[model samples]
Target: MQETIDLAAGPQHPNQFALLRQRRFAPFFWTQFAGAANDNLFKFAFTVMVTYQLSVGWLPPKMAGLVIGALFILPFLLFSATSGQLTDKWDKTRMFRFVKNLEIGIMLLAAWGFYAANVPVLLGCTFLMGLHSTLFGPVKFAYLPQVLRSSELTGGNGMVEMGTFVAILLGNVAGGLLVAVPEIGHLQVAIACVALAVVGRVVAQFIPSAPATDPGLVVNWNPVTETWRNLRLAHGNLVVFRSLLGISWMWFFGAVFLSQFPSFAKEVLHGDEQVASLLLVVFSIGIGTGSLLCEVLSRRHVEIGLVPLGAIGMSVFAIDLYFASRGLPPADGLHLLAFVSQPAHWRVIADLALLSLFAGLYSVPMYALIQMRSQPTHRARIIAANNILNALFMIASSVIAGALLGAGASIPQIFLCVGIANAVVAGYIFLLVPEYLLRFVAWMVSHIVYRFKVRGDEHIPVEGAAILACNHVSFVDAVLLMAASPRPIVFLMDHRIFRVPVLGWLFRLAKAIPIAPRAEDPVAYEAAFAAAAKVLQDGNLLGIFPEGGITRDGTLQPFKGGIMKILETAPVPVVPMALTNLWGSYFSRVEQGGAMVRPFRRGVFNRVGLNVGAAMTVAETTPEALRARVDTLLRART
Candidate 1:
C-alpha cells in the first residue's frame, strides 16, 4: 500500500464534473441518489396515507403528522453519532456496503408492514430506514473530499445536491402514483422501494474501498453528548462553522415554506392536492436547476457572490407569493389540475420556482466551502454536525410555522413573512462572514478580465511543503498564484513594496509576508526567513520571486539567496515557477529602463501565463544550481 498521498498535480480535473464519471465517485453518488429517493418515497407514502386514507378515530391530524415525522427523524437523532464514528473507524466502502444491505432489509420490513396493514410496523420500518440513512450520511460527505481535486469540490457537490433533490421530487411523485395503482395492489410500492434498494446495493458493490483516515477513532454512541462534541469540532473554525450554520438556516427557511404548501394551495390559491403537489414540483425543479447552474455561474469555482444573489431572488419571489394570494378565497375542494389553468395561479408557480432556485444557489456554495476549508481528519464529523443541525432547524421551522398559524396568520402571509426573514438572515450571515463576498470579488476579477492561463503547473508537488520560486510578473502575482494553485501560497516580498500606497494595503490584506533586504533592514529579513520556515512546518506552500523585483528587461534576473536560506531551514521541496505576459497587463509596472510604474496602464483583458516546474530536492539545491535550474525552466517555458 502507498503510505503517502497520491497527488494529481496542476490543471487537474479539466472537466469539473469528472468526479461524477470516476468509478469511486460514481458509485458513491448513485448510493446517495438511491438513498434520497427511498427517503422521500417512503415519507410521501406515509404522509399521503395518514392524511387521506387513515381513519383517525383517536389521533388528531397534527398529532398523527408529528408521530410520522418522529418515526422518520428519530433514528437520525439517535444513531447518527455512532454512525459518524463508524464512518471514521471502518473502511468506508465496507461500511457503505453494510448500510446498503441494511436498506434492503428495511425495504423488506416495509413490504411486510404494507401487506399486513400495520401502522406500527410501518412506523418501525421508517425508523430503520432513517437508521440506514444516518449511517450513510457521514460516509457520503467525507468520501467526496478524499477523491475529488480541490478545484472540483464545488462542482462535485453541486451535482450531488442537484441529483439528490431531483431524486426526491421523482420519488415523491412516483410513490403517490404507485400507491394509487389498481389491481396491482400496494405491493407495487413495496417492490419499487426494494428495486431502488437493489440498485443502490449494486452501485455500492462497485465502490472502491476507501481506507479509513482515522481508524483508531473511538465510537461515541451517546447521541446527546456526541452530537454536541461533533458540533464543537465544526465550530473550531469560524468560517467553516458559519458556513455550516448557513446551510442549516437554509433548511430552516426551506422547511417553513414546504410545510405550509398544502395550506397555501388550498386556502391561498383555492386548489386541491394536485395543485399543492405541482407547487412542490415547481420548487424541486427550481432548486435542481439552480444547483446545477452553480457550476456554470461559478465557472466551476466556489463563488459566494451567488449566495447574496440567491438570497435576493428568494425574498423577491416569496414576497410575490404573498401578494399573489391576496383577495383570493379558500378552495371549496376543487381539484388542482382544473384550477391551475386560471391566470391567477401562475403567481404561485412563479413564486415556488424562484424561491427554490435561489435556495439552490444559496446552499451549494456552503457545502463546497465546508468541504474545502475543513480539516481532512474531522471533515465527516463536521458534516454530521450539519446533519444534526439540519434536523434541528427543520424541527424549528415546523414550530415556527405552527406558531405563525396559531397566531391566525394565513399561509400566504406566513410565506411572505419568512421570505422577508430569509433576506434578513442572508444579510446577517454575509455581514458576519465577509470572506464569502471577498472571495467572490477576487475570483471574478482574476477569471474574467485577466483570463489567467496557467502553464506547466505540474511542477508543484501534490502534497507536503514547498517554496515556490517565481519571476515577479505583476502586483497581483500573489493573488493570482493563490487562485491558480490549488493549495494556499504564502509570499515573501520587500517591506517597502508591501507598504506602497494602495497596492501595499492590498498585499497586507492578502497576508503576504514582507521582508527588507538584509543590508537595508536586517531585522525584517531575518523575520521573513523565520516566517517562511514556520509556514513550511505547518505544511503550507510558500511563494518567493527570485528576481526580488520586477525584471527591467522582461528577462530572468539572477535569483537571490533568500531561496537558499529558506530551503536550508525548511529543507522541503523547492518548486520553480515563472510568470510571463503579465508584465504588460494592468497590474504590471511595464516601464523599461528607469521608467516609473503605471497604474492600470494596459487596462484589463490582458493574457497572462504562469509556468510551474517540478519540485527540486534539498540535496540538489545550492543557490547557483537552483538559480540556474529556475532560469533554464523559465526560459524553456517562455
Candidate 2:
C-alpha cells in the first residue's frame, strides 16, 4: 500500500515542493545532491589541474577530460549489475548510508591526492567516486516508489531530476573556482571535497528505512551473466524494457549536444571558454526548468503522454539549432558579453535551452513510470539495467559523433542529422508501443482541442485488468477517456464508429475493438469479446460503451448488456464514467447530421469533462445499476 499524498495542499505548499520539508524526501534529496556535486567537484578540479595547471608526460591537456570521463564511466559498465543486486537484498537506508560512507572514504583519499599534487592518486579517486555513484544509483530510484504513492511519482521524480542537474552545475562551477584559487587552490579543493562527502553522509542518516523488497534472493556476482539476466528480467515486461531503451536513447541524444558544447561555442559561435560555460549554464537551467514543470504538466502522475510531446520539442529545437548555428556572425575571441550583444546568438541560446528543456521532459516521466510499474522485488535490478544502457549509449554517442566529425561532417550538419534521426527513432518506438502515441493523441486533444477536466479520476486503476464503462458521446469519446487515464485503455468501440475520418485511423493504431451486433455478425461480436478477454487476462485496461453506442439524441441512452458480457468473460471491476457537454460537439450527431456538419459548433478549447464514478464490484455491477451511476454523473453539472 502506498501512503496518501496531501492533494489538497494549498498553492503555497504544493505537494511536490512540500516534500522538501518532509523527512521521507528532504534528507534523501540532500544526500544525493551532495554526492552528485562532490563527484563533479572532484572530477572537474582534477581535469582543470591536468589541463591547465600541470601536464603529466603521459596525459596530454587535450586528452585530460576524455580520460577522466572514460575512467568514471568504466565502473558503471562493470559493477551496475552487482550494485543492483545488493540494493535489493539489503535495507535501502542501510545501502544509502554505506554508499555515503564510501563517498567519505574516497573523498578523504582525494583530499590527500589534491594536497600532494598526486595526479595518479586523483585519477584513482575519480574512478572510486564513480564506483560510489554506481552503488547508489539503483537504490535511489527504487527507494522513491517505496515511499511515495503512485500519484506522487512524477512530482517526486521531477524534483529529483531538477535537483540533480542543479547540483551537478554547482559542483562544476565550484570545482573550477576552487582549483583556480592561486597557490591555495588545490588545498581548498581537497577540503571542500571531504567536507561535502561528510555532509552527504550526515544527510544519509535521516533517510527512513526502506525494507529490502527481495530479502532472500541470492546475489549474482558475475557482471557479464548478471547484466544479461537483469536485461532479460527487465524484458519480461515489454513496456518496461522498451522504456529502459527509451531513456538510454535520451542519454545518447543529450550527450551528442553536451559533448559538442565546447567546440560548438568556440568554433561555431566564435566565442571563448566563458561563452562555452554560458552555453552549459543555459542547457542545465533549461533541463532543470523542464523537469520541475513535469509535475504540473502531468497533473502529478506518471504521464508518458508528455514523452511524445517532449520528443517532438527536442527534434524541433535541435533542427532549428542547426539553422541557428549557421547564421551566427563571424567574429574572433568574442567573450560572453560580445556574444550576447548580437541578436543572432539569442536564437542559439533559445534553441539550446528549449532543446535541453524537452530532454528533461522526455526522461522524468519514463523514470517515474519504470519505478511505478516494475516488480518491487527486482526494481533495483531493472534500474541498474537502465544505468548500464545509459553508459553504453553515451559512449556510442561519443564514438558516432567523433566518427561524423572525422568523416568531414560540420557540427551544424551533425545537429541536423541527429534531429532527423530523433524523429525516425521516436516514431519507431511509438509504433512498437502504441500506448505512447495513443496517450499523446489523447493528451493533445483533451488539453488543446477541448478544455477537458476530470472529476473522480483517482478511481481508475493505474495497473491490472479493469473494465472502463463510459457513456459514448461522440466519435472521439475513446480519445478523451484515454486522456484521463495513466494506462493504455483498449476501447471496445462500435464497429460502425471506426468509419469516422482520422479517428478511424487512430483507433486502428490504438488497436481498439470494433464489435458488430451479435445478431448482425455473430463471429465478429464473439471475436471482439474474445479480444477483450485476452486484454483482461494480460492485465490491461479494457474500455466499453455500456450504452451500446453513442447517443443520437444528446441524452443518456438505455443501458446495454455489453458491460455484463465483458464482466462475465473476465471478473474485473467495472468503472462507470460519463462524458459531459459533448452532446453538441462537431463530432456528435447534431443539426440533423453526423460529424463535419457544424465544425465550429464548439470552438477550440471548448469546455468538456469526463466524470468518473466509483469502481463497482463484479457482484454489484448490472446494466441498470451501471446506467444509473453514469446517468447521475452526467447530470451532476450539466
Which candidate's lDDT is highest? 2
Q: Write the per-residue lDDT of candidate 1 for residues 328-373, one digit (tens) a residue.
A: 6555766866677677777768878888998999898788878777
TM-score of every candidate relative to the true structure: 0.83, 0.97
TM-score of 2: 0.97
Which pairs, if any, clash in model 2? none
Worst 10 residues of 1 by lDDT: 2-11
Mind giving the per-residue lDDT tens digits that candidate 2 earns over 529-605?
99999999999999998788778899888888877777887999999999999888877777578766867877767
| Candidate 1, residue 31: lDDT | 88
Model 1 misses residue 164 by how many Å?
0.9
Candidate 2 residue 276 Cα shift, in angstroms, is 0.8
Q: State the displacement of the C-alpha of residue 162, model 1, in Å, after optimal TM-score superposition.
A: 2.0
- RMSD to truth, every model: 4.6, 2.4
